[model samples]
Target: MLSTGGVVVVLAASVVVVGSVDRGATDSGLTGAPSTTATTQTEVRRVDLAQPFAGTAAAGWQDGAAGVVVPVPTPLAGFSAEQVAGALTQVRDVLITARLDPEVLYGHDLDRLAARFSERDRADVHTNKGYRTAIAPGSTLLGVPAKVAGTMTAKAGRPGELLVDTSYAFAYAFRPPDPERVNDPLHIISVVRVRTQYGFYDDRWDATGLTALDWSSYSYSVDCAAAEAGFLAPSLGKGGKPDLDAGDAERDAFDPAAPMATESTC
Candidate 1:
């Protein structure tokens, strides 16, 4: 659980705006998605999070150094568990580096994230828009650790193009770095989209495009339930256990096909 000190708020009710792209653009992760030959065999299934979602607030997370919880990715057929896990790790690394690593935050290290994206997404990240703004100054994430939760689904959208979609809920506190007084904790619920394909040369899956689908519901409340359930930290278990809402409110708001909101505190 994030130790309570003083309230710190950086971004509130911030909406994520995805830049527009030309369908003809070859670089877009969506544009000619990758495809692979289906080995004649049983169909592969979508993978769930590493831990069960019932009762426990935090599932599928391994404790890491400095109070960080590492998320374990579930794998699917056609894609090895390693491939699925690695892709998810890439997304997390990009966000963490862009917000925490001062050098990468402003240098080319950030551009590596666009290696798999389409031309439009690549340009957007470089042009100081959409993905760029999210990682730019005044948006540096607070020291309060982050929680990543989501699933991976792989399918053929086009004739030969394979589209693997990863939906993750990243809960974090947004407190800008400052020498002055402490700020309020601004709870952020971000849903990120990562597009990838099967690499013919490498004979494996590789990330191509990434984007922030939505950012919303900047609550003042902290998510102690997730911290306790995830890492099973003894200290977090104490005090009143506020429910870690399971449903992704911000993600659902953006998905036209998503079902009605099912409230669960996280």
Candidate 2:
């Protein structure tokens, strides 16, 4: 399920998940067969962004041709959408650096990167096995191309937690010895958590984690077709409004079993 958060396009994933169900009539066998319980899965839609070749032009590319731009979600009471965007950008920077530059990974750079996270997450950043390989050479990782044109609402009551639910495309380039394979552009609607911290020296937000929503649960495709068909658009809320605003009672609910939109083109 999509959780609430500042609209940050970070590389990590995690989030709060809420679920719901609707009861419907079922047929029972005349032979006294057991009746099965039916449950409705939550539907989460991803908004697609237009992708033009990066670096093909002198100045249009941000993260090379695969760089992405995700739309910032509507701001919380005290947080601006731009703030969330900035935080996500920062997180993405670390992720990209972890893969491209080993200096940051081996030196005190990670310490400073860890400083961006909450105390709990800061420790995780230093200890998590995943972070250890984040800067490994010859590793291909997730990339944020550009911000899309939509927003998701942040969950209430959990002031320290930011839930981000949005769809954006991921891109990669193949290296030598491998013939270039042109597959459909991959799109994903992610549910991520960016936790906030209040320390004596600093009070700010950091991407603690990120988790991809299961596309199969909602019957979404793990390819560009789903995005091309425009089925990935953010689900609508009450009164035909995008769920980014309050009163989004009718928006898509959370689904915990949804699988991450992972694909391999090579």
The candidate that wins on TM-score is 1
lDDT of 1 by residue, 57-97 (tens): 22232221222223564544345557555655555554455
Give the runs in model 1 whose Cα sits over 4 Å from its true position: 1-11, 17-108, 116-121, 132-140, 175-184, 187-266
Clashes of 1: 25
TM-score of 1: 0.39
Give the best candidate by lDDT: 1
Each candidate's root-mean-square deviation in Å?
Answer: 18.3, 16.8
Q: After superposition, how far is residue 153 of candidate 1 from its true place, in Å?
A: 1.7
Q: What is the TM-score of each candidate against the true structure?
A: 0.39, 0.32
**Residue 233 alpha-carbon offset, candidate 2, angstroms:** 32
TM-score of 2: 0.32
